[model samples]
Target: MRIERLRATPVAVPYVHDEIWAFGRRRGQVSVLLEVETDEGVTGLGEAAAYPSADIVLAVLRSVEPLVLGEDPFAIERLMRRIELIGTWHHVKATSPAIAAVEMACWDIVGKVCGQPLVNLLGGRFRERVECFFYVARSDPAEVAREARRASESGFSTCYLKVGSDEPNTDIERVEALRDGAGPSARLRIDANEAWAPGTAVRMIRELARFDLELVEQPVSGRNLDELGYVRSRVEVPLLANEASWTRHEQLAVLKAGAADVLSVDNQMDGGLLNLKRSAGMCEAAGLPVVKHSLGELGVALAAAVHAIAATPNFTYANQAYGALLSDDITEGFGGGVAGYTDGHVDVPAEPGLGVTLDPDRVARYAELYRTEGAAFSFGDPDPVLRSPALPKF
Candidate 1:
């Protein structure tokens, strides 16, 4: 069936709790959901990560309407190539997420048309269920520790902690508390989100090593491969490159530099599931394990991630889908509304086309919020400081 229409709906969904990162705090998440309808009455769904700005993603999706409308949904690669060429020719920076949304929808269409699950279409199932981690937002040490304990008690073996505060000691204390509360057996991974300078990252990672971290993510800025490599060399823990690498070339560069022991792959950032699979293949070839990364994804995106994880073989690290963090989602009929994880793992849906149906009423509500309330916070707004700078000691 040929593609008939594409609808990009902007949605503002509230977070279960404030998501505090090094850059900012978000009480709500804004995402653009792309619904592609085929001539044969088949409809596919996808979500674009519109975190700092949903408007730009919506604009990009609208701008590509001429290129996608009436095209064959099965021609995903060709459509992506055309979109990429147009984006490059026009110098559009925020086209990846938009294109990713479209690509995911196309895959969904393919799965439906072929009467197979997305994982089967992508290759086949690698495992029955995909393991995921509980994401703990930055907060007070005691609160963070409490969250970690809850995740552990709820059957999660892994917990991801957001760190990289201006105060190094505070970050250390948070990790220590998390370790204590998690009881030493639970795996803890820290994401710095590129908050530290090279020297600061080295020193901080060294000090934090006493807590026995599973890995440290993006300790230094993504652009500073040399600095990331230096910090990796200095620390005994595995350094995972999140913001540092998105595309295959960047992944190769980081691998060549010996900068990261693990590669964190996000479908939204890498463009789509296909691109993420390609990057994972490269990582597998290089003897590196790939971990899935999430950017405040909802049910649709989380379902897409589960399918991707099911098809990927070298994905040993606990994946981050973040669907549990959202107060509500736009899809339903799964463990936790099509995106929910049960016992720290999500079962790969056996049905066709992402294996989830959209909740039209909830989508309408979020869409109204997007149209009226807009985003809770934008990236350009003054950075939210979790902690002030420390006084210099004599």
Candidate 2:
């Protein structure tokens, strides 16, 4: 069936706690919900993490809709290629993310049409549940200890700490406090978000090795593969690559160079499920582990990630897949389908397709709020016209 219309809605979601990371700090999630309608009366949903504002997301969606308006939704590859060609002129992430929103929605339609979940449409499940780790929000040592204590008491098997944000000494103190609070049972993972120089990363990794971290992600800038490789060779802590490995080629390059032991593959940044499988295949070929990355994604992407990690044979480690821990979701019921985790391991969903459903009432509620917030711009303006409210509904 041909795509009938595309609509982008902006929504504001509050965070459970103050979110402070190497990227920045925030109190709420600013996101854009992408809705696509087709001639067959089928509709699908997806979301893009547009921190700072949803205007950028709306603009990107409006600009790209015309490129695929009358095209067949089933020809996803062709649609993606055409969108990419149009996207080359603008900011790559800004353009690519909106396209991803549409791509995911189309896949949702495909799954619905075939009477299956998105994962089943792509491939079959490899596991039942994927283990998760919470990204601790504390910056100070005492607060880190408190948060880690709460997480341990909450039944989480692992926790992720934001390192490289403060002085090395300060980071060391925070890790020490967390380790003490979490005890030896809970795994500890650290992410620097490429906050440090190569020298500092090496130094911090060597020093933090005493705390027994599971891995350290993007300790140095992703631009210099050589430096990343050098740090990997020099440090004992396994390097986990996020921004450094975005595609299958980059993942292969990182593996070939021995730059990382683990990969942080987020579906939004790594294209979609098929590309995620390809990247995981590269990791499997090189005998590396694949871990899911968090992008303030709602339940849709979370379920998609769970299915992907379950479908990949090489993904043997736990990751920050605990979206349930960070988000105050506006859709669905309490606790999306988690297969269960034991000793830092999780299984995949046994249900058909992505094994999840969107709560329409919640979608409508959030959609209404989105329109109210985005109505500041006139429909006649070029910006608002691109994101037409007059788009067809399923």
Candidate 3:
């Protein structure tokens, strides 16, 4: 079927906790939902990771709409090549997310057309359900402890805590509280978000090693693989590369350099599901485990991740699904509304396509919010300084 129409709607969904990370505090989550309708009456849905700004993402999506309007939906490879050509010709990174959204929609259409779930199209299911880790955002130590306790009680086996703040001592305290409150059984992972230098990361990982952390993620800048290797060699805890390995080329570079013990992959950063799968295959070949990364995504993206993780064989670590962090979601119709973890695992929906449906009314409501209130921050803007002591430059 020929692609007929492409519609993109920007939505601003409130975060449940107003999470604070190394970069800044996020009061709300923003994304642009893309709907691709074919002439044969089949429609597909996807989400663009707009993050700090939805306007830019919308503009990019609109710019690429003409290239995809009359093409066949099933020609994903050819379409992606054209999208990449346009992106490279324009010298714009924003086009990546826009292309990813459209590519995902095409995959959704393919899955629905075949009467199979997205996972089935990706080489069948490897597991019945995908396990997700509880994400503890930056907060007071006491508050972190409380949330850790709640996560344990709620059947979560692992909790990922945000660290790498200005005060190293306070970050240590938060980890201690989380360790104590989460008990001995629950695993804890820390993400520095590239807020520390190699030396600082080494020192901090040495101090935090007493708590038995499952992994430490992106302690150093994404640009320095040598520094990452330095930190990884000194620390006992496994160091995971997040921002450093956004693309397949980066993934290979990190793997070749032996910079990290594990790699984190995400659909948004890798461009699309097929690209993520390819990255996972590379990691699998290198005998490294792949963990899924979350960018405080809504249901549309979360569903896509769930499907990808379910089909991926090397995805052993507890994946992050921040859908529970949202106050409301637009994908409520197909069981994508509120994020729920059952005994620390999220069930993969067996329904056709991406297994999530969008509610037009809710989309309209959030779209109105996007137009009126705009965004709280822009990805292009400088990261908000949360404390006084600046992070050490590499």
Candidate 4:
């Protein structure tokens, strides 16, 4: 059956507590909601978020729908390939975010068609739950330790600490305390958010190496690979690449350069499931592990990651996929589209097609928080070479 209609709605939700982290805040959940209607009368829903403007993301959704509209939703790989072909030529930065939403909806459609959960469709679950890595934002070392301890108590054996926010010494103390709080049993992972200089990254990783951190992520800047490689060579701790690797070529380059040990794939930034699988396959070939990086994803995206990870072989690591810790707004109560995390690990969702459904009443209330105020709007200029007629009628 062919896709008949597509829709995207961006929603924003306020942070209920200390929901803000180094990357952004829970100040709002700006998710791009999607609905894909098939000619056979099957409708599927999906959700994701964009760091870029909602208008731009919406435009991306609008642009890509036409290419796949009259195509078979069950022919996922072929549909993805078509979308990628169009994305490569058009310079659509939000292609992955848009594709992820659409791809998920397609998967949902397939699952409904087959009368199976997405996990069953993708393959089958290797494990009931995916291990989680708790996230501790920039804070006092003691506070960081406390949070780590709490996460450990909850069954999460891994904790991802946000560093490079302060001086090297202060960062050192926090790492030490984080390790201490995690008490050696829990793995300690640090993310710099591309906040350090190359020289400083080398120094910081070298100093923090004594704590035996599970990995130090993007210690140096993401823009400079030579510097990244240089820092990677000098650090004893495993250097995990998060923001640095994006497309296939970039991931291959990072691996060939001996820059990273772990591949942290963000489903949104790195395109959709198909691209993520491609990247994970590359990592598996290289004998490296893959983990999904969370960017404040809700139940739908999180569930997709779990299913993807379960399907892929050699994903030998836990991901920082704990969005529930950052927000209790998943009012569906941990099954019907609500993600649950304990001790930094999440039990795999058993629902068909992400199994989580948003509470319409809550969604209506929260969507009001989405503001276009101060948004630097960009009516994207279509690529000169590959412009197609707008399918959604703009």
Candidate 5:
């Protein structure tokens, strides 16, 4: 079916609590939702995180309209190549979410036209249900303990917490609290988000490893593979690469440098679901496992990733999702929050395409939310005292 037009909607949905990371905090998620309308009355849905910003994603959509309209939605490979090389968007990695959204929309359309779910199209289900970690947004020790306790009591096997705060001791205390609350059986994973130098990363990760951390994510900067290798060699905890492996190209570099034990992949960061699958395959060939990374996604994007993850074999760890943080979702009965999950697992949608449908009323509500209080929901940290927060905080 020929593509007709693309609809891009920037929506902001509140998080149950503010997501605090090393450099910034966000009170909610901002995702630019895409709907690709086809001449055959088939519409495909896609979602992209407002990566650098929502405005960038919207501008990308407008700029790419000429390349997408009148093209065959079924020819995703050809269409994506045109957008990347011909449109000269291949090297601009920040523009990936927008391009990925288009590619996602095409896959959705292909699934609908062929009367198959995305999981089947990508590969028949390697898994029927995908496991996700409980996202414990950074807070005081007591609150961290409480969140961890809830995750453990709810039967979630993995609990992910943000570390690499300005105070190293404070991060240690929170990990201690997580252990106390979640008990020893729960898998505790921490992400520093590339906030430390190699020497400091080794010291802090060694101290934190006493708490039984399952994996340490992006402790040192991603730009320098030598530093990453230094940290990996020094720490007992296996390092999972995030910023180091945003694209397949970077992933190949990471592999060549022997910088990481586990790799984190994201369709939004690269280009599309096909790339996600390709990333996992590349990692598998290198004798490494991959995990899905999220830039704080809502339902549409979450469902799209689940389909791809379910079809792929190497996603051994609990993938990242914003379900614990999002207060609500725009979808019909899937991927909302804790209510949408069972024991921290989300079943793959069996319906055609994404197997999830948008709730129009909820979409309108969140769109209005974006219009009114969108400034508070951006990736930018609003703490005025922390102007231009720098990483490698020693």
Candidate 6:
């Protein structure tokens, strides 16, 4: 069936707590939800993280309408090719989330038409449930400890926290506090967001090793693979690549450099689910595991990734997710916050397509929220000084 029109809605879902990273803080996640209607009266749902900004993602959808209109929804590969080569978005990585949303919609259509779940279409289930980690909002040592305790009590085995504050000692103190609160059994993961220098990363990771961190993410800058390799070689903690591996090409470069122990992959950052599978295959060949990275997504996007992760082997670690942070979800009953998960894991829906239905009322509520106070949820710190910090804060 021919494609008809794409409906895009921008929504801002509030977070239980402000997600504070090295660069900025967001009170919630901004997702550009999409629905593609085909001439055959089939509707496919998709979601895009407002990477960079929501305005840019909206503009991309508008720009890509002409390329996507009148195409066959089943011709996903051909449709994507036109959007990439003819539309000339191959090199423009920033437009990936919008393009990915459209591609995800097409896949949803295919799944519905075939009367099979997305997991079956991609590959048979390797695992029934996909595990995720709890994201602890960065705060003072006491607060960090409390959040870690909460995560442990919630039955989450893995807890993630952002490091790389201006003062190195502050980050160390928080890590120590998280370890103390999470106790010995829980796995601790820290993301520095390219905030440390090679020397500083080595020193900081060595000190933080006392807490027995499961993984250290992007301590040094992602731009230079040598720097990542330098820090990785000196530290015993495994390095998970983020900025260094946004696309397949960059992932290949990272593999060649032998920079990271574990790689972070995202369907939104690359293109779509097919590429997500390809990324897993490429990393699997290298005998390395991949963790799904988030630009901060909600139910629709999370469900889409869950199918792929459930079907694919080698998603060895509990990937990054926003469930611990989101105050609510737009979906009906599934995939919003910690409540959507059962013991730190999300089960793939057994129904067709993405298998999660949007609660239009909640969607409208969040859409109105996006309309009125969208600025508060963006990836920018309200504090002017915190908005722009010198990278490699030693």
Residues 179-251, candidate 4: write the lDDT tens digits.
Answer: 8888877778888778777787887788888888888887766667787889877878888887777655578
Q: What is the lDDT of candidate 2?
A: 0.70
Task: Please tell me which predicted candidate would have the highest lDDT against the true structure.
Answer: 6
Give the local distance difference test score of model 6: 0.91
Encode model 5's per-residue lDDT on 1-394: one tens digit a residue. 6999999998999998889988878899999999999999999999999988898899989989999999999889999999999999887754469999999888888887788999999989999999999999967999999999988877799999999887888999999999999998899999999989888999999998889999999998989999999988888999999999999989999999999999999999898999999999999999999999999888889889999999989999999998889899988998778878889999998888987799999999999999999888986575724566676777
Task: Kindly provide the TM-score of model 6 when superposed on the true structure, using C-alpha atoms.
Answer: 0.98
TM-scores for all candidates?
Answer: 0.93, 0.85, 0.94, 0.86, 0.98, 0.98
Clashing pairs in 1: none
Error of 5 at 169 (Å): 0.7
Candidate 1 per-residue C-alpha lDDT over 1-394 given as tens digits, one digit per residue, 9 for 90 to 100: 7889988888888877778777557777778999999999999888898944787787777888889888999999888887778655224322357778999999999999899999999889989899988878757999888888878877788888888765678888889888987887999999888888887887888888888899899988888799888888788999999887866668889989989999988778767898899989999999999998877777788889889888899999898766446778887865332136677898898889899888899989988987888745343224443334321110
Count clashes in each candidate, considering only residues at least 3 apart in sequence or on different chains: 0, 9, 0, 10, 0, 0
Off by over 4 Å in 6: 384-387
Task: Mark the regions of model 2 whose C-alpha exceeds 4 Å error after superposition.
Answer: 51-53, 86-95, 322-327, 334-355, 360-394
Clashing residue pairs for model 4: 13-29, 129-348, 132-344, 132-345, 154-343, 155-343, 156-343, 156-344, 336-356, 337-356
Return the clash pairs for model 2, or none.
Answer: 117-353, 117-354, 126-310, 127-348, 128-347, 128-348, 129-346, 129-347, 129-348
Tens-digit lDDT string for candidate 2 (189-262) = 89888888788788889999999998898888777789799899899889899878866667777887788889
Q: Model 3 segments beyond 4 Å from truth?
A: 86-95, 333-339, 377-394
Candidate 6 lDDT by residue in tens digits, 209-245 = 9899999999989899999999998999999999999
Candidate 5 residue spans exceeding 4 A from truth: 384-387
Using TM-score as the yardstick, the better of models 2 and 3 is 3
> Once all C-alphas are superposed, what RMSD does model 4 give against the true structure?
7.8
